[model samples]
Target: MSLEVLQVSKQYGTQLAVDQVSFSARPGQVLGFLGPNGAGKSTTMKVAAGYILPDAGDVLIDGISILTHPIEASRQIGYLPEHNPLYMEMYVVEFLLFVAGLYQLHGAEARQRVAGVIHDCGLEKEQHKRIGALSKGYRQRVGLAKALVHDPKVIILDEPTTGLDPNQLVEIRALIRKVSQYKTVILSTHIMQEVEAVCDEVVIIHEGKLVAQDSLKALKQNTTEVVFVLETQEEMQSKWFDDLLGLAKCHLISPTTIRLEAKEVFLLRTELMQVLNSHGLTLISLRQEERSLEHVFYELTAPRYNV
Candidate 1:
């Protein structure tokens, strides 16, 4: 499954919720929709799922517009909105049955699928529990089970991990990763770590517009890729590392370390060692830092042109 949002925008009265955002995701990949609170991430996901129409532009799944073919589009999509709704009076199995009916599933087919997803989502322990009686974690699992009941090719999840305990979060995240093996997943969240955990790509929105889209590795290099830790016999205050700050794109991260944003990393690494040797500095420790997603998030979300 492939999802494409083309120049989409949404407005309510005078407020624009999404501003001409465009992106695409493919099967076997999780495109992490990320932004701060009220950054239009949820609105974008809702629009893509056809729950909300865009005032301008269109959402396409496999080249079919949701507006022209809502049912067909929805048939290919399974959406778990930020606030999942459940009939409190319905038991876990009953709610799924009701949802299955909407998708025209019945008889043994529905029962088999419901059983499969219930097991996959870890809802077996609470299968007989009513929605109102279950804990928040179980409610979330129920929501996910409902989404999976139809076995759609595309899954759009909005803040799926919100309001869960740490253990629940880990379990749900693992389930999501397991499911993504066969489907296209568009996961919207304000949490940065979620993207780092399972996402293959990232689409960052800000103030109702698409700002940055890239793999996490490329984004980290926007600031610096090389994390150099040098501990010499000299005191921390020694100017040895300070002098190396004159190197292009080098940042002094600490008294003993600096991060280098070199254009040619391999050449720079060799040259850097030579420079250290020339300075009569004994390099006690030197290694490229593992690129981190937290650093990438900060750079991509930070105000452009310093605001």
Candidate 2:
């Protein structure tokens, strides 16, 4: 199923949490919703999930408006909120079964789907344990299982990897990638690496406004300038790059690594070769970094964050 938010806006008392923000998600792809804290990502997802009504505009699930057809639209979405509300006293299996029942999945089908989801989410080892006993990572798995039990076409996740360890983070990222094959996954996060790791498309918000949205590859090279990481076999002084063609700035990131920024990457790369040859320095690696969301994010949202 496809999910589309059109000119959606929301307000809380005196603060405008979201202002005419719009974006989309398609099946078989992961669309990342990114923003600084309080940028209204959660608010937009909530409106799309039908948990709350928008002050203006609408959300459509497969062309079905969440506002006009709340029940039908909700039936098509599986949302895992930032906090991941779960009954701590309930066993993992029991909680999933309870959730399945809410959607009217009964008898053999409920049991089968619960079993399948447990296995899919890698919750088999901890299925019989109470939710309170599971660590945060496993708890997250259980929450994901809950979201999938209904077999919804669109899965909306809000900061699902917030507090995971590195190992758990990788596992969850893999699971997200695995699930997106047949489901429209809208993942909300502040971590740029997470977006780089799994997202096909990106939507960035800043101060409750939509700032940028595009394919991950397109957004990566969208900025006017590009950064290159130059590493040498021998440690070099920053002054060696002085008067380099259109070199905006240079910083020593490591003994053998220097980060360079320029308006035109081609010019910088060409001059870098000449400069290295002039210094008799053997270049280990000099390549344009593929990472872009970090630079794009801070550039667009710096006012709210860097203040």
Candidate 3:
């Protein structure tokens, strides 16, 4: 594992910010860290980056414990915080050089690394401008450039694309994907599309608890309820599908269209075909509905409604 968060917990006064939260990320893997506001996402990321200590448990980067050896662990991690704070008066290159200095990078090596990040983060056009004068999109690029300037093995990005426009979102997402080829990336974002676009796996936190963690494919497979849309040539009553085998429910979408919810999709598909054949109903179309990441997120995080 490139990054391991072992039973981490944090508390503020009487409130438990994180309760035994644990997860790991491997090199070249992009993990999406998701949660609603005040769900301890930032606190966990802070502990992972060695900026704050967990009340219990530990975080390790490349086998070095963050709690015991923060400096060593910090060397292996590049963090872009939610705010992306930067000095407004400083020139973009100057700011990067300053970050490079924090890593004790000096002379030709520091210059080369700064230049490399400038190119890598698509900041070449704004490298010479003052940080205050750059657009929000370019400012975000500068923040990312600073994070990558140290060439760390693990990257932690917290809401890195929060305020970006659609074009900027696309560009930043591409940059994250490019960097994940060689580093372990933990991206914190509320946007479902971002997770789908860049993450290999997803870890969801709800009320400071780990609710779901798995590959995108596996999560979908495990959590998705199979729904099928059926269109017939002739109108049919909704009750016609109420007796179908393995069906959870049926919806009357239109006079000639019905949507079926099934407990077992594969078995239901075959059974549906048989029923249609026996009834001599002309099937216009039948297809399974693909669940979106947004749906999964809501399902995992939403408050339960009692029947």
Ranked by lDDT, top first:
2, 3, 1
Residue lDDT tens for model 3, 1-307: 3999999999999999999999999988899999988889999999888889999999989889998888888998999999989999999999999999999999999999999999999888899999999989899899888889999999999999988999999999999999999999999999998999999999999888999889988887733368787898987676666667778766666677776767786645577877777778898988887767775676677654221
Model 1 over residues 75-142: C-alpha lDDT tens digits? 99999998988898999999998899899999999998899989999999899989999999889999
Q: Model 3: which residue pairs collide?
A: none
Off by over 4 Å in 1: 222-291, 303-307
Candidate 3 lDDT (Cα, whole model)?
A: 0.87
lDDT tens digits, residues 1-50, model 2?
89999999999999999999988889999999988888998999889888
Judge candidate 1 at residue 276 and give its lDDT.
69
Worst 10 residues of 1 by lDDT: 234-243
Considering summed lDDT, which 10 consecutive residues are worst modelled in model 2? 298-307
The list of candidate 2 runs beyond 4 A from truth reads 222-261, 264-291, 304-307
**Residue 235, model 1: Cα distance from true site in angstroms:** 28
Q: Which of the predicted structures, 1 or 2, would earn the higher TM-score when compared with the native?
A: 2
